[model samples]
Target chain A: MTGIVVLAVAVMAALGFGLYRRTRDGRFAADAAAGDGPTTPTTPTTPAWTAILAAHPDGELGERATLVQFSSAFCAPCRATRVVLGGIAEREAGVVHLEVDAEKHLALVRALDVRRTPTTLILDAAGRELGRAAGAPRRDQVLAALPA
Target chain B: MTGIDPRGPRFTAAVTALIVAAALVIPSANLSALLMFIQGAFFAVGAYAGVQYTPTAVLFRRVIRPRLSPPTELEDPRPPQFAQGIGLVFAVVSVTGYAIGPVLLGQVAAGLAFAAALLNAVFGFCLGCELYLRGLRLKERLA
Candidate 1:
């Protein structure tokens, strides 16, 4: 009887663990889908956009284009993105790259609707939006997004 | 950081995941048992790690302790020892269930772990702390 009970417990634990993994996987997929929507609201009074642009007083607009990546120090993916972005920028003199520490600027995140880390916003010389990429854009994808 | 309960969130998530995983693993379930076992292992590790570390104790001494709360007759920040004792028991039982074989009783432990993890992650709450506090109260009663 004792042996039977032990067997029962092990089987149950295994079953419970399986359910949890499924739930977690499902939630991750859902979060990915929701990322595209501009659901998050910005702070009413803060002019975060203006501040961001003003902080870069050099006004050095890129000839290839500009890529700004918002990231946090502890985020692993952000580190990888930084390296990739840097390599891309080095190759294309026109492709200027910049990074902003997200933790220091919550206002900017809300204004830009930046829900996830490693969010890249691309802009042309005149500060017009060319395109944007969330998560880690593939090497080819990053290059492809560059303006000719 | 010394006293702060890291175990609460980790413990809850690991167990919750274990229970949900185990329940889905029916007789026909192929990969279910494997998944649950991994989660169960993580729970065991988390439970053991939580009690061993004393983040709150260190943090209090370094920061909060130095800046005293202006003499308001502060109660002890720690929860009862029994809470952790119960948690330890649960961890051992849950791991044992995983070891022997699959059974419904194992699910009960997994379910408890899952609930604990959810509360910790979503609300920043700690069940371990509650258990410890209960243990302390019991001790006081006995005294």
Candidate 2:
């Protein structure tokens, strides 16, 4: 009786977590100073922005904002992220979509403190960090995260 | 990136959850091993050959696919199969727990795995897959 009860409770908890995860759009607000959001840390604890650019495969920043997507080879959502981000890049003249294989670029992924596949880092024209999101985001959500 | 039908894995997860949940409720010694054996085969086939060969996949391809409407989109099978590999690990541990000493340990393992399977079946998100992705990322970072 006790085992069944525990299992039931566990299932309910897992369901709760899964529901919470599914509804969350990968929207990390662009305010670091305000300090309380899903934003990846308030500031860069690593090297300069230019140096970070050098480490990534696409050495050049976008004319306005770059969509840096880190993906693994077998990640399903990475494909979806590609379609969404690539679509955004196509419509917006100034934005560019760049994808890096997380497996191949482990060091860079580590440097950026990426914890998941389909992690997108938004960078300005000067390669300055604007915002970051883990998991696939909708078209509008990505747009909202970009630096204006 | 196996561009397979996305529903197949979910179908299997649902079945796995049902059986594992039943096992938890029953707490039979034979059912314990049976659950492991069944789930183990499913995960091994999914993780190794591909998702197509897994027992539930086969059933889905035959009975379910014929009945339901076609999938609107196809998804990569790797993540769910990776999720299966995670299931296999838990199933193994649970089986070991049942065989060696405490039956409760096995029940606990099954319960944990059942929760994951249930999550995948109901929520469409595989926490096991997420954990696997995190593990891969961590391994990349640590190494």
Candidate that would win on DockQ: 2
* Residue B4's lDDT in candidate 2: 88
Candidate 1 residue-wise lDDT, A7-46, digit = tens? 3554454456445533431021112222332222222333
Candidate fnat values, all: 0.00, 0.57
Please give the lDDT score at residue A42 for candidate 2: 53
Predicted complex 1: DockQ: 0.03
lDDT of each: 0.50, 0.76
**Strongest candidate by lDDT:** 2
Off by over 4 Å in 1: A1-51, A55-59, B1-143
Cα error of candidate 1 at position A62, Å: 1.7
lDDT of 1 at B91: 47
Interface RMSD to the true structure, each candidate: 14.5, 1.9
| Candidate 2 docking class | medium
* Residue B20 lDDT in candidate 2: 82
